[model samples]
Target: MVHRKHNRVDGKGRIVIPVKIRQAMGIEPGSMIEFDYMARRHQLVIRAVTETDQRAHNRET
Candidate 1:
């Protein structure tokens, strides 16, 4: 696992993404990003896209 240290956002609620991580994750300018939290587990994750990317993997209900 990689350990990274970053600071919090400013009053405007904007945070800068480090260049190394951006390249590693293939994140480009204006790319879509999503954040999900598991309340029970107290965990948060940042992902590159949303559920729209999983339309093909859905099961018939």
Candidate 2:
């Protein structure tokens, strides 16, 4: 399920992800996240790197 929430970056460049969005994405404290900045599109992508993803990534390395 995809969820969207509007957030503003603080002075220190930190943005708080809404609680509902976090829960929907299975994100919790200490979870690892990957951030990608699409310069061409001027967009930022945030993704959670779960254990399964890490395992797959390790195998590819």
| Candidate of highest TM-score | 2
Over 1-61, each residue of candidate 1 has an lDDT whose tens digit, in order, gives 4748587999998887788777777779877777799999999787776356545335432
Full-model lDDT for every candidate = 0.73, 0.91
What is the lDDT, from 0 to 100, of the residue 19 in candidate 1?
80
Off by over 4 Å in 2: 56-61
Clashing pairs in 2: none
Model 1 accuracy (lDDT, Cα):
0.73
- Stretches of candidate 1 exceeding 4 Å from the true structure: 1-3, 50-61
Poorest 10 consecutive residues of model 2 by lDDT? 1-10
